[model samples]
Structure formats: structure tokens, C-alpha cells
Target chain A: MKQSQLIKGVLEGCVLAIISQGETYGLMQALHHHGFPSLVGGTLYPLLAKLEKGGDIVSIKKPSPDGPARKYYMLTPQGKETFQNFQHQWSQLSGHVNQLIDEVHSNDENPGHPG
Target chain B: MTKTQATLDEINRLTEQLAPADQAYFTDLQLYLSTAGLFYDEAQLNDQLLNMLLDLREANQHGQSARAFFGNDPQTMGNHLIQQFPQPKLRDQLGLFSLLLGISWVFQILSSPQTAGGLSLNLVAFILVPILEICAIILIIRILHTSIYPNNHHQWWPYLLTGLIVTITISLIVILNSWVTVGWTFLIPDPWHTILLAAMAIGATVYLLGALLHRWRHHQA
Candidate 1:
């Protein structure tokens, strides 16, 4: 599958995870820092809007020290709950996937060792 | 000014700060986003657009081009963004329809030629023409919105051809309207004609002022 298609499923939770930290630009910075450099404002802003619409997050426009007011995003109580749930689900899914991959690699290394 | 207007003003001011190339790209995106969705939550859409614009400006300051900061294909991105907006309520659509119908009805009354006997109007034309005109307008807007994008490189001939077809179609409809005078004629006597025109003008002015005031107050709230 295309990497973008794979990311599409978890991007909402990833975004919520970032916004849970604080601020809008930090979400972009964090995503880039974590290796998803292709995700830009075009993708991020819409996801942010969707999260806001869903009541998972909220933003307040505050005056920035450098320039005009910036929208600072924060997790609502609902958003926090949703993010915690995501964390639990991701951990379980990743653990299972990793165990299966390790088994496949071991089987490939030791040919004819099935049972 | 309403908050919406204030947000719009801020958007205009910040849009000027973009580099020429970036400005053009942003303008095309703005036009598409604003026009493609007719009845969405306008205030929220503007707010989000402003937020995006601000981010683009910051990225520009860091020497990143708009296409680099905001993806290459605006059409796809715009469609995705528009989907996040709340859909328009039925009442909003009906409100806009009524407003257009009311304004067009008044305009037709004022522009039609008067005669010695009275102001003659075709009842059929009065209702049908406005509806047809509204449909034409929506069609034109849709065409214009779809045809516009920063990367579209088709020649001008197609646009010119489309414009010609639209003009001819509307002209034919109008001419056809004028010829229908059988059971559809309505006449107002001279005194009532004057009174009707005066009343319509006054009503339009009052309604416009009231709407503006309400919007301003709503923003203040």
C-alpha cells in the first residue's frame, strides 16, 4: 500500500497527539521532526478543522510576540480521553504486528522449520 | 462591522504581504474555496482560511515557497478542506433564494418600459424569467469556479466559446419571454403603479439597512 494511504488512517490520532502537547505550528514541527516531512499545511489544517468540528480539540487566538495573533490549539477533555484511547489501541496493534513480523523473519531465516 | 467582515478585512491586509507569485497562488485558492461551496459556514471558512494564510506567510518568511509549504495541487487540497466545513442548513439556502428572487423582481419592475395606459407586465415572464435567470447565474458561477485554478493551462478559446454559448442561450430565453403575451398579461393603473414602485423601493432600503444592522450587532455579540 502507498505510505500516504497507510498514514491516512492514523493521521487523525497523530494530529490529536500533537495538538495534545500545545499550539498549531508545533504540530507541524513535531510531525516533521518525527519523519513525516511530506505532510504540510494543506493536509494539517483540514485535519485540524475536522478535529475542531468533532469537539476533540479547540483553539484560541492569542496575540503573538512576533506578529499577528496565532491560533493556539488545546485538547478538550474529550480530546484527552480520545487520545488516551488511541494510545492504548496503537500499543496493542503495534505489539501484535511486531510479533508477527519477527516470527516471519525467523521462519524465513530457518527454512523448513515450520510447526 | 461584523466579526466576519473584520476577519475578511484582516485577510485582505495579510494577503498583501505575500510575494507576488505566492499572492497569485493564494488568490486562486481563495477564489476556489470561497466560490465552490455556496452555503457552508462562511464565517468559519474565512477564519480557517486566514489561519492557513498566516501559516503560509510564516513559511514564506523562512524561504519556503507556497507550493512547497502547502502541497502542489490546490484543487485536491481545497476539496478536502471544504469537506471539513459544516454543511449549509436548508433555511440558509431558502433565505438566499428568497433574497435573490426579491431583488430580481424589483429590478424587473423598475426596468420595464412604461406606457400611456399603465405598466404592462407578463405574469408568466415575471415569475419564470427570474427563476431562469437564477439558474443561469448558478450555472455561470459553477462554470467559472470549475474552470479557475492556478495550474490550468488550456487556451483562452474554450472560455470565450463558453461565454458565447451562455450569452446566446440567455438572449434566446429573454426574447422568447417577451413574445408570450396571451393570458399572462398583468397591468397596473398609473396611480397604483407609482404607489407600487415607491413601496418596493422603500421596502428594499429598509430591509437592507436592517440586515446590515443585524449583522453588525451579531458580530458585536
Candidate 2:
């Protein structure tokens, strides 16, 4: 039941990245649509607090389509930088792993070992 | 159509999983709304409740008293609050209920006769209570997900699930009486289960009655 340290970073990082693209509400809805249900209305409070405190997020009081003011969160330029850095690191790691996997698959098919 | 009725329904939903004292807070909110020239109606009531929730969240976010201290207009403040409110849930209910049940479960397992805690002065239950408390927590989350969350697809299903789960979990000790008897002969049987169940039943009864009473009082007004 323990989430790996990597997954935790990825999930939280992805949330911030998604928020950088738009408002928090839409980000939450998009996450849910993508089957990441971490926005259980409970998990978000602390995560938002942490992200804001970390200077990776900011919230503005904005009106919604329904005529109510909601707090909309977006990334600052610094946050965008953080997002890009994290994305690059993650892609580098995953890409290397993928290449290794592909090499092993091709090796298995070729059976280069002496018979 | 009245704001009061709308507020009542809205408050009912927001504070649905809250206690009588917590419910009273919403009544105080109603009084505030009625002061703003809003005829108490269900729609405006929902609006008010939503506004109050936003106000509370704002207070939490900024660590201030509704952000304006005191010099602001009430209706303007209220409308501003609604523009930024999030949907409400029973976070308070879940917290208190989880805590109480957690204490109870820890008491049961630690006070378990076969355990070393039961063999001694049961101080071990106090110690072991915290140790196993982590697992109880995980179990509690699992319980909420399996036994309670599926019902949240419906509007009132969460309420029913909260009531149902609380009732059933409190009854676990009763149903486990045989196991306790066989496992530990010297441990005296406790009635906390029955007491909590009875208390819960009465609380539910009083709440429903209180709703009707409020309705009657509002009519008389």
C-alpha cells in the first residue's frame, strides 16, 4: 500500500504542471477524467498549501461561470521553470529505461548467446 | 423558493455530516443572512450557505476573520464569498467519527484478553493502542472506501453511509462478544457499544425532530 517515492513526486509534480496550464478546478476535473482521483476534496487542501508555500503555486480569487468567486491557482514563471525541469528529468529517466527495455527485447529475440 | 428554505437545504447538505452543535452554527449563519434583507428562501439559502463555506475557507486560507475585519458591507461580502466557494463535504463528521471509532477499536484490540496488555494492568493497551493505531487508520480508510464511498454517487447516500457505518462499527464489539468471551475469560464485558448505538439513534431522532421543530418555529415566525 505504500506509494513509491518516485510516484509521489510524479503525482504532486504533475498536479502542479497541470495547474500551470490553467485553473485549479479544471485541473482537478482533468485529473479525475484521467483516472487520477487525488482531488478528493481532502488531499487538495494540504497539497495546495504545500505547493503555494513552496512558491510553485499561486491562487487568485476569481469568479466562476456560475457567478461565484472561486480561488483559481496558476503557476508563476518560477513554477513553469520547475515544471519544465521536473518534466525533463522524468523523461530522461523513463526514456533510458524504455531504451534498455527495448534492447533486452531485441536481444531476447536474437538470442546472441552461444548455443 | 424562500431563502430560509433554500438555506436550510443548503445548510442541511453542507452540515449534513456534522453534529448538533455544528448544525447550530449554520442557524447562526441563517440569522446573519436574514439580516441582509434576503427573504429566507431555498435558493438564496443555498447561496448563503455556499457563501458561508467560502468565507470559512477564506478565513482558513488567509488566517483572518473573514478577511475584512469589520468595515465591509454584509451583502457585498456574502456575494463575494459565493463567487469563490467550493462544494462542501462532511470532513468534520469524518474526522470526529474516525477518531472516536479509532479509540474504540484500539481499546478493544489492546484490551484483548489474550494479549499481554490484558494479562497485566492493561497499560499495554495504552501503549499497544498507539502501535496498532496506524493499521486501524488504514482499516478506517478502507472501511470508508468499501462500505461508505460507493453510496456517495447519490445525494443523500453519504449521510446514510455515515449513519450506517457508524452504527455497524459500534456494533462490532457486540457481534464479537463470543470471540472475546472465548479469548479472554477475565475481561468484563463493556456496554460502550450499546451506549454509542443508543446515543447515535437518539441523536438521529433528535436531529430529525429538530428539523421539524425548526420548520414549525419558522412558520410561527
Candidate 3:
């Protein structure tokens, strides 16, 4: 609870979801809108490598106009299915979370959750 | 802006933190981002899809684990303390061995008297320097044993540099000693000096052989 298992689940969900598409370049950029550069080397490479090795993700090389060739990691057909499964689980979990958020009422004057 | 540009922007900041030489790996990272944007969020998804495909290719190539290849763990929030750096115990062992050998060399010299003149010089060189060189070579062998093979943790190029430097340093010490004193030996006696030189030569030979053995092990791995 202290670590927020939900966050890890959400991250895996989001990462897996990205792979569901054909392929990707920088996941941080795609997911940056959610929260990205916030977790750089610490969370990025090892996760990407693991996801690739796990057989849920596949990475390849494609030439880049700006620089050298870029490695693109894409979710396989299997990865797409995984993404859907995680998505489904997340949806149900988020619904309950949303209800909880809605139930908690706070005065406009004290929104920060203080004494 | 275009999706690629927008996605590139978000990740480029994080990419900046990596070393300049590793830029290509970042491009692959960019590709990963572009793919994920297609999916919004879902309840549950299969986690092993991409990995399974990669495994097939890497299987022929012999798949390397994240911990072995990148020295990192992906399951947690940040880099695991164990994965981020080199093993400390090995370095500690090397340092301890160096200290002990240096002390032993000093003690050996202090206790042994200067037998002859040039003989003394040859004796000390044959005796003392080999201890230092032996310890250094042993340490190098230990490091390379753990550092090479199917899943080397370190970048290989730097190890080459360390080996070259260690060899030259030991050679320099020997050459300088010869220049200052009675040639190769301590001028003990005519024939004994030759024998002593031969012994010193043997010490250098053993040290060089040890280095070669280490290199061979590294290549095989």
C-alpha cells in the first residue's frame, strides 16, 4: 500500500498498451503525457530490455533521418493481447478508484489535505 | 507538431542523460514510445507478447538476461544497488592482496643481506619486483575471469587499456633499475649475476605468461 502497487500496474499497463500498436520509438515520449522523463535511466532501459526478452515486446532497427538508425520496439500480436488484458483489468480497477475519489468530499478552502 | 517530433521531444530530455556514444540505443527508445501511444489504457493485457518474439531471435543469438547484459533490474522503481555498480568484494580483494604482497616484498628485502655486489641487485630484482608483478597479474586474471564471456557486465575496451598500462609500468620499473645499477644484476659475481639475471628474466616471463593466460580465458569466454 505504501508503495502504491497501482502505480506499477498502471506503468506496465501503459507500457504494454503502447506496444499494442504496430511499433514505437521512445516510450517515454509516448507516455510522457502521463509521466515520463520523471523516470529515466533507472526505469527505462532495463524495463525495455526485459519486456523485449519476455517475448511480449520486440525491438528492431530503422534508419533515422536526423541521426543514426533507431531501435524500435513493438508489441507482437501476443503483446497486443497482453495489452488488452492489462487494459481490461485496469479499467475495472480504475472505476472503483474513481468512485472512491468522488466519494471523498473536500472544501474548496482546504483542498491540499491538511490538518 | 508531428507525432514523431512530439514523441521525440518527450523522450529526448531523458535521452540527454545517457552518454553521447550510446545515442543509437535512444533511437530504439523513441520507437518504443511511438508504439505505446496507440493504446490508451485497458484492464489487463498479456505481458509477454513482445518478449516472446524477441526470445526467438535472441535464442539463436543466445539470449542475455537484463541483469547480466545491462547490470540492472527492471522489476523495481530504481536501479538495484547490486546492479548499478561493480562488485565491491572483488576490488577489496585485489587491494588487500596488493598491500600484503608489497609488505612481504619489503620484509623479504630487509631480512636478506646484500650477498655479493651486483649479485645483491639481481637478487632483489629477482625477488622483490616479481612479488609486485605477480600480485598485479593475479589481480588482473581474477577480474577478467568474472568480467568476460557470454554476458560481460563491463564495456570490453577499457580492460584492454588496463592490461597495457600494467605491463608497461612493470617494464619501466625493471629498465630503470638496470640503468641505475650494475646492469641487470647487482654485480655480485661474474657468473652469479648472469644466473640472477636469468632468474629475473624468468620472473618477467612468468608474469607475462600469466597475462597471456588471462587474455586467453577472456577470449574463450
* Candidate with the larger TM-score of 1 and 3: 1
Q: Model 2 TM-score?
A: 0.35
- lDDT per residue, candidate 3, A3-111, as tens digits? 3344555676678876666577756556655554243434555566556656778777676674444567888777788788988888898898887666564434567
Weakest lDDT window of 10 consecutive positions for candidate 3 chain A: A36-45
Which is the leading candidate under lDDT?
A: 1
Binned by DockQ into CAPRI classes (incorrect, acceptable, medium, high), candidate 2 is: incorrect
The TM-score obtained by model 3 is: 0.36
lDDT of 1 by residue, B1-221 (tens): 66788788788888898888888888888888888856777788788888888888778887888888888888888888888778799998988889888877787788665888778877777888778777767777676678776346766744775687579667855774577767877788899899999999899899999999988886786
Model 1 alpha-carbon drift over 4 Å, by segment: A23-26, A108-115, B150-153, B200-221
Task: Give the per-residue lDDT digits (tens) of candidate 1, residues A32-100.
Answer: 777787888778877888888899999888887876677889899999999999999999999998999
Clashes of each: 0, 16, 53
Question: lDDT of each model, Cα atoms only?
Answer: 0.81, 0.52, 0.50
Count of clashes in candidate 1 = 0
- In candidate 1, position B50 carries an lDDT of 84
Q: Write the per-residue lDDT of candidate 2 for residues B1-221, one digit (tens) a residue.
A: 35446545545565554445434444444444333321223353455356445544433344433222211233343333333333334674456556666655545544444533223223333334344444444454444434321334556654575566556644653444433344334432345434544665686699899989878887687
Docking tier of model 1: it is: medium
lDDT of 3 at B160: 80
**Candidate 3 docking class:** incorrect
Q: Each prediction's DockQ?
A: 0.66, 0.02, 0.08
